[model samples]
Target: MSILITGATGTIGSLITARLAEAGAEVKALVRQAGKRDFPAGVTEVIADLTDVPSMRAALSSVRTLFLLNAVTPDEVTQALITLNLAREAGIERIVYLSVIHADKFTNVPHFTGKHTVERMIESHGVPATILRPAYFMQNELMVQQTLRDYGVYPMPIGSKGVSMIDARDIADVAVAELLRRDRAPTALDRVTLELVGPQALTGAAVAQAWSLALSREVAYGGDDVAAFEGQMASFGPSWLAYDMRLMMAGIQAFGMQAEDGTVERLQAILGRPLRTYDDFVREAAGQA
Candidate 1:
């Protein structure tokens, strides 16, 4: 079976590509640049703009499953819908989407809303679909590591609502299983909302504590102040991303976007093994750093 994965160079997408290749599925990756290849030689690299239907269709031919993992910037919604339509046209039987937790209610945030829109598109498109809605990534901790080391601050707009931070690798494992399973019942594929999660559901302060231990220094948790966090994000990202970040922070704060335990148990059963913990992810990331 052939599988097509978008966002081939990203953190999570890279993991998905590698795992699918290891599983011996014919792997195809859609990249925007023709000359800029970063993954293994085994992956079939196709150059196509994700927003272009004709371009996407060329890459989607003969693909049985598509693992959707693109991280969008500020762009028109029609661009994404067109891509999904192309996926359908190319005879993709099953589609797996990487979505944000609580995607349905995240209208204020452009990125989360973007994910929700795509999920809707997938449901309407008549393809077998499984939506993996993971919470904030454990890899997200690395963004503030240097700040915590230099200034002892790990600020979050995620608010007091504890997030069940997930490791991207684990999410990849789950997605791979969903893609490879041939006997998936229609009821199983109808509307699967699997909340990929870490073993421990920690508050923001607890996440900081893990960082402090990893860095061998103190890391303080700054309160949920949207303006301050937006300022920090603006300095690093484009203005639209900063605006999207703030809107997302508001959702996490008000809706308490933490996952209940059922999702974790479900993930364990699906994988036929225990899930990785945040500590395990932190050690690997820290070692790489």
Candidate 2:
């Protein structure tokens, strides 16, 4: 069966696309610009925009399964809904949605709320779907690589409260499992939601220590300052993005972002191996640097 993966060039989506293609599935990568990047040998590149429903029609043709991954933008809700409605119209058999962990509880956060809304739409739309709600990505630390190397500090606004950050590759593995399972007997995962998290919950200090061990340097936890965080984010993007991120960080500070009990166990069952730990990710990242 052919599978269409949206956001096919992104961190998690690229991993899923490669794995699916490696498994010999007919993989169609939905890219806004087709010739920009190379894909797996057997993968087909379909030029389409999620916001334009008419443009997606060709991409959804003959697609049995779809990995819906929308960008975290202000128009996330509209974009997802448009694509989902088109997928349903195209008679797609299965959908795997990449949502955020604790999206239901974090309604105030724009991106989280958008995912929750899309999840509901998937359920009500009668599409057999698996929702993979993953925690904050451990790879997110790569964003502050410069600061870590120069200042020896982990400069995120996650605060002292712990979060069960996970590796994007693990999330991709689980997504591939769900997509490949269409040939197997119907399981509990159909129309089910799973929280994907790492082996342990870690605070800012723990993250700093992990980096220190990996880089062989003294790395300290930079305290959470919303204003400073917003300013830093704004330098790279728009003021609204910084504002939204500040609110997300503020929410994380007030209410921790730890995973639920048995989250790791569930992920292990899907992966058939131990979940990747923060230290493991750190060591690998350090090696690449």
Candidate 3:
């Protein structure tokens, strides 16, 4: 039985797909359209959209494991619920869901609330799944690279509370391990939840300091200004999405996206190495800058 991956074109999904395929596992990637992207050799491309029932059914057919990752969209709830219900109908043995950290607690954030709703359904229905709750992606800094280079500022409004920003690559590695374990088991594994996070929590100023060290110059922390951040986001995308992100950022600023104690130790044991640090990410980003 093959492992089917949704959101397969995205950064973390792509990494997981490539690694699974390289490990000689049977893999299938769900794509909205064909020929728009490429996958590693021996990986099957399953043309499907999350909202298209017939297509989703075909994609889930004969699949043993699923990596359920729906992009944050207006209809994220509908898409995820539909795909998940279909997975159950198909009797899929294992599912790995990518959810945000503190999804249940972040009730005001649209995407977080939507994921929490899905999490509730999964728990209520007893789906054999592994829920990976990851914190803010360190790679998100790539979007502000130009700003950092020219203005010497770290522009994200992650505040003084501190966030344990995780690496997408590390998330992918943990996902691959979970998928393999569930898929190779003789019977379906029990449901589980894993909080994915970086090794240490860093505040906005700390992140700026890391960039400063990496670039050998002073970099200022762009203070917590969710309104300004929202306005900036709205200039590039839908206002509603920007507002939704504003709520998420406001929540982050108020309550920091921190991992529980010993989370780092547990993650290290799982990956057989230390978690990736923001300092390393900064150094690499600066080197390329």
Please report the candidate that would top lDDT against the real structure.
3
TM-score for each candidate, following the candidate numbering:
0.91, 0.95, 0.99
- CA lDDT, candidate 2, residue 51: 85
| Per-residue lDDT of candidate 2, residues 139-225 (tens digit) | 888899889999998989787777888888898999999888862435324587888888888888899999999999999988989
Candidate 2 stretches with Cα past 4 Å from truth are 183-189
Clashing pairs in 1: none
* Native RMSD of candidate 3 (Å): 0.7
> lDDT values of the candidates?
0.78, 0.86, 0.93
Which residues of candidate 1, in runs, are more than 4 Å off?
182-191
| Order of candidate numbers by lDDT, starting with the best | 3, 2, 1
Candidate 1 on 151-184: residue-level lDDT in tens?
Answer: 8777876667677778777888998898777324
- Least lDDT summed over 10 consecutive residues: which range in candidate 3? 29-38
